[model samples]
Target: MSDASARPKKEKERGKGAGAPRVTARRPTLGHKWLRYLQEVRHELSRTQWPSREEWIRATQVVFGLLIAVGIYIFVLDSALSFVIKGVLGFGR
Candidate 1:
């Protein structure tokens, strides 16, 4: 009874009939599509702002530092947990 319910019936009556077939999209050939995609990728890469060698080296160092820190934290935590588990189960013998 509301406008929302009545709008669909009106739209359906105005649109394609119930028996009309649906239209499908046609894709480009593989070779042409690949060439176009590569060109677009090159264009996008050219527009990108790349980091300098110094900046890249600094970023890599930071990443490695964090990785080592996390590795050490996990190693310590695992060792503690293993010790506790062995003590609780009396398996240290």
Candidate 2:
């Protein structure tokens, strides 16, 4: 059975000698909703602490440095494995 607390007030009050509550709030239109969403995004972006050019460049360089290191390690590992496999299988190139 569904919990009574999970139901809306109008639904819960059904057959309970209570009237449905009148809604006083109006829903915003689609255009106004989009405008409000964009305004919120702009406000949040303004509040965000952005990284400086030097920090971004240093971070990018570190990422590239690690990328190159990983690539070199993988290449060396693959070469070593290939050499061992070829020797074991008596296959040469």
Candidate 3:
């Protein structure tokens, strides 16, 4: 409940605009922003470490193996549920 907290903070004056219209902050142009983004991307990419061919291949194999195992598990689960539902409803032919 201090007076400082209740009152708004004052902005510092810049370049003799006491009576002049308030000047808005300047923003970078579109081309300048794109160029800066590309520069940052290049900097980050240079710092990245790529895996060896053997390591990459092993990781890819692991991902594919897990995908196949999950597919089989889902198929088995769906088949079992379908069989149970058909038996309960006497819809099996």
RMSD of each: 8.0, 7.9, 6.2
Separate clash counts for every candidate: 0, 0, 0
Write candidate 1's Cα lDDT for 3-65 as tens digits: 888676643587877777778887889998999999999999999999999999999999999
> Which sequence of candidate numbers ranks them by TM-score, best first?
3, 1, 2
Which scores higher on TM-score, 1 or 2?
A: 1
Best by lDDT: 1
In candidate 3, list every pair of residues with a backbone clash.
Answer: none
Best by TM-score: 3
Per-model CA lDDT versus the true structure: 0.91, 0.90, 0.88
Clashes of 2: 0
> Where does candidate 1 clash, by residue pair?
none
lDDT minimum window of 10 residues, candidate 3: 8-17
Pairs of colliding residues, candidate 2: none
Model 1 worst lDDT window (10 residues): 5-14
